[model samples]
Target: MYHRDRSPCSALAVSRSVERPRAAVLLLHGGHEYGTSAPGAWNLPAARMVPFERAVRRATKEHDVLIGRVRYRCRGWNGGRADAAHDAERALHELARVAGDVPTVLVGHSMGARAALRAAGGAHVRGVVGLAPWCPPEDSVRHLDGRHVVLLHGDRDRVTDPKASADFLARARAAGADASFVEMRGSGHAMLRRSAAWHELTTSAVTGLLGLTPLSSPFTGEGRLLSGA
Candidate 1:
């Protein structure tokens, strides 16, 4: 069953399955407002999370998927990746408290990616997935050691630049993380639903990262190594 609630901090959207429960995917929205609940108020610039939601639902046909569209300060001095990560960590803990101890996968876009990485620090998170995540702080590299990370970026993305995500992924791999990169050719930063390219790539990456074999996107071999910025 999927549930939506308004918390003192931010609004919550969760979907869980009673049958075929595996792990959980925690979706975090990109930077926008601090803590406001209004329609389309927190729509991130380059991070299209709507289709990601649908993709997760389809992929988790046999598992539970939870999405948390948080509203934290993402503007002004207090509104940055660091603050986003701090608040996101709190929100994940709250969700975990309600859902019990289940394996978690963190999915973030843009600034949320930084937050997800920070939250994964010392937590029981299974993996971290960043979609067009910006350059993280140098100190943040230590937190990703021995963690599973999947970084996705569009080759035509101009907002965050594909090379930025590639560089982060490279550093993540160097830090001993099981990190991989996927380049979506011809796709822009704003992911269009029903987009064959976007759908295929996301479906493959999400499923593969979660240890599922997708018949639609069969694996032949690892893709190309995206060069650093």
Candidate 2:
């Protein structure tokens, strides 16, 4: 069943399959580069991630995996303040309170991906799935040691630099993290061009990171290329 959990700066749409979850996945939605306004329920970026929430729920229906979609407090990254990442960290803390230290994975898109990557240093975070992430040059990979990181970026994206994500992956691997990158050809920043492909890859990545299943072909190898169309 699904329920809502509220915090000072964020909320969670949680789907719990068991009383105490064996694992958990938190979904973060896309947003702008700079905006301080609060995001309402009907916001387009939040709405865009609804399908992913459903896909993950279905993929882990038989397992005791707790799924949560985080509603950020603001609509943008807001420079170095990283408000969204703080909210994600809060959500993770809340999840820990409800689920008790079960392994957790974060799945984020666009700006949300940046937040997830920044928050992946949390003790409970076991892995991260970044979709068309916005990885700036200043982003660091040192904290990702021993964690699993998978980045999926569309080569055609104009909103975020795919090359930056590639560079981040290179640094992540060199830093001792089990990281991989998937170049999604023909897809763009919005991930609407090949929606199904994005969904499939996301599901596979989540399940694989949680050890419920093996990763799909694209993520089985380092820096694999996949057709997003």
Best by lDDT: 2
lDDT of each: 0.62, 0.85
Over 1-229, each residue of candidate 2 has an lDDT whose tens digit, in order, gives 4345655544565755467689999999999988899886588887778888889989999899988877688898999889888888888888887788899999999999999999899998999999999999898889999888999989899989999998888888888778888888888888888889889889999999898998666666654434443
Worst 10 residues of 1 by lDDT: 215-224
User: How far does residue 84 in candidate 1 sit from its true spot (Å)?
Assistant: 1.1
Q: Which candidate achieves the best TM-score against the true structure?
A: 2
RMSD of each: 4.3, 2.1
Q: What's the lDDT for candidate 1?
A: 0.62
Positional deviation of residue 211's Cα in model 1 after best superposition, in angstroms: 3.3
Decoy 1 TM-score against native: 0.77
**What is candidate 1's lDDT per residue for 12-89, written digit by digit as tens?**
445443433455677766764354333355455424677776777786676554445545544311344356776677
